[model samples]
Target: MTQIATIIGGGVIGGGWAARFLLAGWDVRVFDPDPEAQRKIGEVLDNARAALPGLYDMPMPAEGALSFHDRLEDAVQGASWIQESVPERLDLKHRVYRDIQAVCDPAAVIGSSTSGFKPSQLQEGATRAEQIVVCHPFNPVYLLPLIEVVGTPANAQMVDGVADTLRGIGMFPLLVRKEIDAHIADRFLEAVWREALWLVKDDIATTEEIDEAIRMGFGLRWAQMGLFETFRIAGGEAGMRHFIDQFGPCLSWPWTRLMDVPEMTDALAQKIADQSDAQSGQHSIRELERHRDANLVGMLRTLKARDWGAGAVLKGHDKTLQAAGRIADTLSDIADPARPVLTVDRAVPLDWTDYNGHMNEARYLQAFGDATDRLMQIVGCTPEYIANGGSYFTAETHIRHLDEVRAGARIRIETQVLSGAGKTMHLFHTMYEGDRALATGEHMLIHVSLETRRASVPAPQVAEPLARLAKAHDSLPRPEGAGAAIGKR
Candidate 1:
């Protein structure tokens, strides 16, 4: 059964929440009085649809239904989760909560995308105080995984459920131990934001210069290792204590106006706006969003490859998605053994295309390689088996590029096991976009003993299943381009 999520506002943050929930297969109903709410949310969804699915190698769940409601009561009727993203005014939040609790399920989770207000504040005067919690997410909520979940001790179980729901949608829920103003990440961000404002006021750096200082320097380190871990490495052989002892004395220096707030006078505000306009005003906001999304996808893919930091979160989400039946799990899951096995089903990521405005030649091999890996896993050559000293090594490969493919295109690969006997496994893989053939790859692989680094016989566990697949595939018509050498066609 599809779950329902209600959005109380349809601005950037609210739309992001809607997109995240909808893409994760939850039916979303939105209530926003703004006449243009649907159009605005549609724009955000467009950006999300292009970017989010590319993060995974497997298929995302089919998007859920989205409906805009004029009445607040209608929107919250049967919703399991209600997210309030209204402007940051306590009285307004209290009013919204009163209206929500009147119609929403009493047991439903009411989450606030409040950056500063605590749950206790949001729950004040509400019919059900325990239902509300702070589920503050970063901008571009569909991409960035961090969500600060703040609730009082009385709301502990509700907070846990909120975290589990967030993880289901590929989000990292950092439960705030103590409900505080601005939660955890925002407090750190506020400090930096305050200092950045002062630097611009003092003429020390322009907006672009400040951004450059971050994206070009500590920001990269922060992306993968974060603050303390990065600093621990900076400590050299002694670790955190030694580095802090040496650099801690500099805390007393007058290098920053961290505690001081620069007055945002009209003149100062204009100056900053003018500088920012000069820095990045050439591109439209949507273009800038696309650029940021592409860069983020690339960086996140790197981390996912290494299984570090935010990348680890993405990796774990992929496993969760796979377990949810996005892909075939075992030989029995294949519906028709007479046909080739469906091995890969995913969208081409933005990074896979090049200056040619088409999928790069190398990415074809990468996709085919993934298909081969999937087939290996299906026939009992799983990660655990490989770890125990048995795996396939590609000895030779032939690829034929049949048609052009581009980023954001959904593609699939079907594999035919031509032969699987003794120490060798030969595979014929065909790539497709819908029903159109995009490419084909023929590969010859040898089962190897990882310990001796030499070709070796397969274990019975792997051999029997692979042999069965090969026998099943033998009755099917041979692939058209299976044996053709390069340039022969």
Candidate 2:
């Protein structure tokens, strides 16, 4: 329901936020002080728009309008939500907030993508103080699920409501109990960064070594579940209290100076840069970003399978998107019943895949989705129908993968409408090779109005064809499966 969003910054973080909101189907307006903000953001948005929609199992609706504003007030006007990702400086943020207060509607929520600055500090002198809060997201804003929401006492109620709204849009909002410098996640990150600096400064470990130690070890688990949840599981039946009791001694160790900020010396800076250069070699910045996004898509999808923490957020977002519908081009492929279809038989090329082997998991869903799209088109649901204010939104889906699929496999998909109704439709999809079923996806879809965001009669142009198909299959028994659930919760 977050239909219009304004992004007040065109840096990496702001661009990522724009991608996230735009992909989620919000009309996005971007404002930034930099003269080249639009160009930089456009480049980022180009990759984002190409990669984001393809991550899901359903075709996402066409991205909403993406426009840039030379003035912050112009961007904030009438926006439902405003995200400020401006430079991390107090005076600039204050100026922006003052301008936002004068322009943003009373109902709109204003969030600052600040890593550490508190709401109290960020909202100083703002007339509409309750509307402002800090929403700290990690780098690669579009991929990471966690956004720390820090609110001052005066704005806590408004911020909590905003957090819920963010959840509705597929973001995980962690509400900080109290305001603190650097907020919560950054505090932990700052600690690690401090140690990383010490290691580089003393020539004890290379940048790659430190990265490996974390990634090959705890970093993997931390990516899916946070530090505390992992520790809770690690304690087995003992729970958090017991785990804390056992490891509390580490708290006193001189291993990390959590409060210390390392001095920026040229010798240490050069060493860090040289080590990083040696670690990454000649990969371009774009390549590195693609790698990061690919890994994020894979790891997040894996965690989504477990439906714990970050994965839970991804799943929830997927559900929200299910309502948006996707469009796929029809292909002239059918399933052959006699062979074992490999998973790679039906795949779509996602723009974000890196040099790493295998398609990222999000793209796997996207591939199966491409097959689903072709199936829908074959059955007569076209973009023209959707544009006429009628479209199919996926309600639920269950996909089973029997094997691993690598990239570049010639894939085909077969679909069967499991059931249909005025408001709901069910489909069975099989990704296939020439004669085999690789993966099966059963989905339920709802017919909806684009403007209402509610169930509505399908347009005659689209409905007539679907009704014909329904009649053709009426005498045929429903597929030996459950139909999609219909009606509102």
Q: Of the candidates shown, which would achieve the greatest lDDT relative to the real structure?
A: 1
Model 2 TM-score? 0.70
Worst 10 residues of 1 by lDDT: 480-489
- What TM-score would every model get versus the actual structure? 0.96, 0.70
Candidate 1 lDDT, 1-489, residue by residue in tens:
879999999999999999999999999999999999999999999999888889998888888999999899899998999999999999999999999998889999999999999888888778878899999999899999999999986688777888999999999999889988999998999999999999999899999999999999999999999999999999999999999999999999998899889988999899999999999999998899999999999999999999999999999999998887546767888888778999999889989999987999889999999999999988989999998999999988999999999888889999999999999999999999999999999998999999999999999999998999999999989999887863243
Number of clashes found in candidate 2: 5
Flag regions of model 1 displaced more than 4 Å: 451-454, 486-489
Model 1 lDDT on a 0 to 1 scale: 0.92
In the range 252-358, model 2's lDDT, one tens digit per residue, is 98877556767978988988899999999789877888767667666766677788767777677766655443332322232431221122222233443545655
**Clash count list over all predictions:** 0, 5
Relative to the true structure, how large is the alpha-carbon lDDT of every model?
Answer: 0.92, 0.72
